[model samples]
Target: MSSTDIEPAESRRPARYHAKREAILAAAALAINEQSAKGLTLADVGRRVGLTTTSVTYYFKKKEDLAAACFSRTLDKLLEILDQALEEPTPQLRVRRYLSLHMARLARIQAGQEAPFAVLSDLRAMEDPLRGQLLAGWRTVFRRTRSLWGSPATRVHADLYGARAHLLLEKTFWLPVWLDRYDAHEFDRLEARMMQLLTHGVAAEGQSWAPELIPLVQIQDDETVNRDAFLRVATRLMNEVGYRGASVERISAELKVTKGSFYHHMDAKDDLITACYDRSFNIMTTAQRLSDTVAGNHWRRLSSVLASILNLQLANGEGLLRTTALTSVPAHEFALMLERSHRIAQSYAGMISDGVAEGSMRPVDPFIASQGLVALQNAAFDMRSWASTMPRERAVALYASSLAFGMFDDRVLEAL
Candidate 1:
């Protein structure tokens, strides 16, 4: 054939290739929704879209590359939303609209349809250039977000408003795990409950922060165990900020102790971080085992487990490391925390599966439900600042109910 005769076929090939790439990206996003970017595999994504793993690589060579692409997509979507939110005349209204719109989008994404934006499974998984680019983009949105409460001249005041807004926005990002099939009405109710908790704090009704002397390894013995108060405060700092952001110097200062005191207990900052993850996972697993013995079927048992986790986070200082995903830890310790965390998630899923079999709970995807439950459990730790505002029990009950029925009262859910 003449070269001209083959031109049309060759031209169409690139178009077809780009279309396939887009399909793979969409499929990857859905798969990541099920099991974040860290847990996602090229093979699984390929299977979901009816492509071979080898074929999938033709579009994105490495899983991290694909992950980076996913992260970029989510970041762009987030930036777009933040931009639209800025169009609102006031900051609070902007924040509310941003959240409500984002919640509705979550429902769409989980349902395997189009969404307003995308999400990243693991930020650390992406390369520096890609990760930095996306994060820088996010900062722009955040700066605008901070302005919602009016620009505070004081850094601390600005931070408080930013923290509250970000905390509320962060939880909705994980709603796919909680209510994959929710409608507009459900999103509105869920948003209302969230806003209520956000503005008023999680104090159940008339109660205020009633400090109890609950022990959490609350042990004060050896230098490694608890010789200094730095570790306890470190746990909170790490949970509130992150390991990188929670440096030894900062943590020591926060405890009103010297760096020497912090050094006296742990070998280094990384070691301290490792210890924190170890302690956090150990506490959660212990709670899980204890809840396993609670009276009733899987649903009740799950509730008891949720209660135990939420209360521990609220009651104990060490439980302050509130991240649901462990990828944030240094790569070396990632596997250990992830394995243990996965087991915990599975235990939750197993309970849902059991309840379904036992006829004690409504039908649901055990895997997604378990992941959703754990996400809620982890996020509850962030409510510590608000915990002091009300009765801890009331806050815990509200969290439990929110997990069971997203944006719903039990009565409202039943009527639906």
Candidate 2:
């Protein structure tokens, strides 16, 4: 039926009531793109769909219900991608095609032509059974993606293809944010190029890759007797399962320490997460500073910074700090961490701005470009499985080259 046929406030239910509800959920998805679900009101949703607030409430009693329905529908879309990829005949082709199609989808969003996929906030803010159900759906996609695409033999650990997939997927959710800075076009090229680039290191034939040195930056280690070990263990858990899954009990079990030992180090899990965020960002800051000390042009500086950041995982086995960790921190710490994140971005933009000014890089919006770089480097977390299977230096070089050059031909990178 046409949209015009749907009544704004039908006093009686029609046989197509479920279809109408689905329509409302579609509108909710569009509205959610502009504002988070928590900030979204029933009136706003009604405004987006040309319905009265009462009419909206009639379908989904609360705004949360509407948002929940929207998220559930997104899960349907995600599953569709998985199912489509599974149709491909080869494992590598399946993975490549899946990444390509998904990147193209994100490009559409970057061009302001479509709504974003569900954000992390969307999943976390959702209450109860719906959240659990949605995450189960998400996990199902990862498991299927791994089984259908990942190689059976990986040095990272057998059956840990999921870890590698997570690493690649880490940046996909945030792709639209910075992707607009580049030419918004069919991104299948990016998928194919990146896949090939990753398989074959960016090193020109017979050109030896000199591994850059990145030191382990120390963190605030006074929290406990073995704070360094404790933090390292916590970082592993956070990277593996995530902040939510890394319970104090689980972390303690891994550390072979009792709950009292954990308490001795930190008062609670939230505090531990806060410390992890602090240390992770501090490590990045240290890398940024070290990148500055290198004697080279801005392009060289940016490359060094990218290499150093990737080396956090490549050299040290620590993943990049997640921005979502800020929300889980205390309000005051949240504010602080939020500012710190901005500073890091700003510093990154500064380097890009310098690059543009000096003619080492093409002109682009430094802010957006910096963010895009950060999002890409986030794949360093994939190094969990990747570093094991691939040489760290080679992996870092591939990431730096692909991110710097993207789909564009830049001969300068060849010499850099």
Candidate 3:
């Protein structure tokens, strides 16, 4: 080889470094998605990339560092997508552009052309400065997404637009869980259908937001109150942190009870989480069932179920366990939890299908709309703080109406 053709040591080193670092990040993201931040280990990530744990340390000094990097990469990608979407001339076009770009990216991942982004559900499980940093990045992503609907001129506009922003991002985050059901060739058609729902909404020409309250079947006095207490605390902790982060000791300490007391109510940590899921699903089923008993159009029944659930989520008592916990849930139990979730989604789908048939709703894809509803309700727990500022009824209407109405409809504001 000619001496002039030989690359400098500095150039060769940087190229090699960049390639290895990218590989490590890709592997770490996949591992975190599978097992969550708590389950991530340097050794596991290294094994995926054909490196020793010690060698991996050369790129990221700690597991938390690697996890943070993974989250940062995801935020970076989101900001990039938002930037592309913002270039469009109108809010509707911006939203359509955003979803189209994001769907394309997800399809690429599904087709093995790119690595997956780390799931942001476990962001709370990380320790500070990493946690703080990741959260700030996420807030930026959220603010940029909210901008897709245009700038808000008042507090009410801000809240309304904020709800729309959350709804959009949550559905985007939720795509990976169900997007694989479609063939890669169907992505364009799916995106168009999804955008229709996002822009126009599920309501018919003049469907109103007058949801009758669906009464839940109250728990009997004979039920063990202590077990309910455990579920409440565990559910909140798990929502704040994650499944593994909400350990037995943590739950016991929060309840001011002994570890023995915890075991007395539940068999194990897994059992507690499983029970939490059961409780959430039961509440959902009760609302769905009771809505069926109500006399109205399908939209009335659907809106009642949605409003009632949002009420439960915003109340001071125990709320539903978010689907984000699925990331840290054990594999064996994961499928079971997901099955229950699918059934709840199917209930929503059935209502939507009937509404469409009865001409009470727009001709939206029921499966897609149902999934969007799930994303809306599942993420409402995080909106409790936002919900607190206004009257509970107004909060419910504003937030629930994000999907109950469409992204562009703001008549819900006039009612408030």
Candidate 4:
């Protein structure tokens, strides 16, 4: 054979190697999204890509390394999108273009034209150097997302922009979970409706930001059990780590109790998580029901419920377990938890619908706005440090303002 022919055949080795490596990454990302970074098994990832565990290890030496690579790729993709968005001349156009591009990317993934990005909810599950690296990448993505709102002129503006950036990024992260519910052809309309809500918010013309604070009532069933401490500690751990990352042993250690004490309060780890969910849902439902009794318009009721829940999230006391843990939930229980979440979102949607009818809220899509509200409150736990810098009420107001008014609105600064 000629030397040129031998050289061409040898050159194909690198291209084939890269192609197989990309395939492994795509499979790993999908598996990580299905289970979680902690729950991911090299064997499982290998099976998804029709390779042996050792073969997968050739591409990624360890499972944590593989998971971190997946997260890094996602962060890289997000930064690219943000860079594209920065090309716009105005913040409004930048935000719109960002959403447009992001929604299109999601649509392409749904259409099987692109590989799925690993969900970053499980970043906390990773250990050591990987965790630090992923966090730094996240900070970069956050900073770029903040830049979508243009440069902040003042400290207060910076805070407002940070909150807005968080809201926007969380909503984008949240889209994949619910996007499957819509048809691919309808993605354009969905994007347009979401953009409208993000632009004008849910408030009607001449509406102000004042919302009554609703008192919370203790759940009756929870009062029957003296496991509040266990549930609270468990919820906190789960919120910090993920579901699988927050093991029974970890919860017991945090509570300074033995495994026996934990078992005494709860039957199993799943049961404990279920109790935490119940407690959170009860708190939310209590706020919603109490808001109904407040003497005001639908917008008032909605804002009060949001503020009350956000306050619960920001307070030093026991806070809501983030929905990010859902990724680690068992398949059988996932449906039930999702159903409960859907009901709460429906309650928010009902309020939005009433607000629109009563001329208190803008004529935006109730379903989209309600889901946006869910994304907002669920992500508030991440901003507790930011909240600590100001009064709890002001933190609640400022954070909730992202969705209450609009991502672009700075009225919350004046409202306080």
Candidate 3 CA-lDDT value: 0.87
The TM-scores, one per candidate, come to: 0.53, 0.59, 0.94, 0.94
Best by lDDT: 3
Question: What is the TM-score of candidate 4?
Answer: 0.94
The local lDDT score (0 to 100) that residue 24 gets in candidate 2 is 75
Q: Summarize candidate 3's per-residue lDDT along 31-104 as a digit string, tens digits.
A: 99998899999999999999999999998899988898889888888888999999999999999899989899
71 Cα displacement, candidate 4 (Å)? 0.4
Residue range 1-416, candidate 1, lDDT tens digits: 11122356546777778677778888887666545565668998899789999999987798867866766676666667777877888756676777777876766755657733345434543456766765675666557666666666554344345444444455666665446445655767767655543333322232222222223355455454344366567777766545555678898776667888788888777677667666777776776677656665656666666766677776655464655334345555766666676788888777778876876655565655566566667766666765655566755654455445433122212221
Model 4: worst 10 consecutive residues (lDDT sum): 1-10
Clashing residue pairs in all predictions, respectively, total 5, 0, 0, 0
Ranking by TM-score: 3, 4, 2, 1
| TM-score quality measure for candidate 1 | 0.53
C-alpha RMSD (angstroms) for model 1: 11.9
lDDT of 3 at 147: 96
What TM value does model 3 have?
Answer: 0.94
Candidate 4 ranges beyond 4 A from true positions: 1-13, 217-225
Provide the overall lDDT of each model, using Cα atoms, as 2-decimal numbers: 0.61, 0.63, 0.87, 0.85
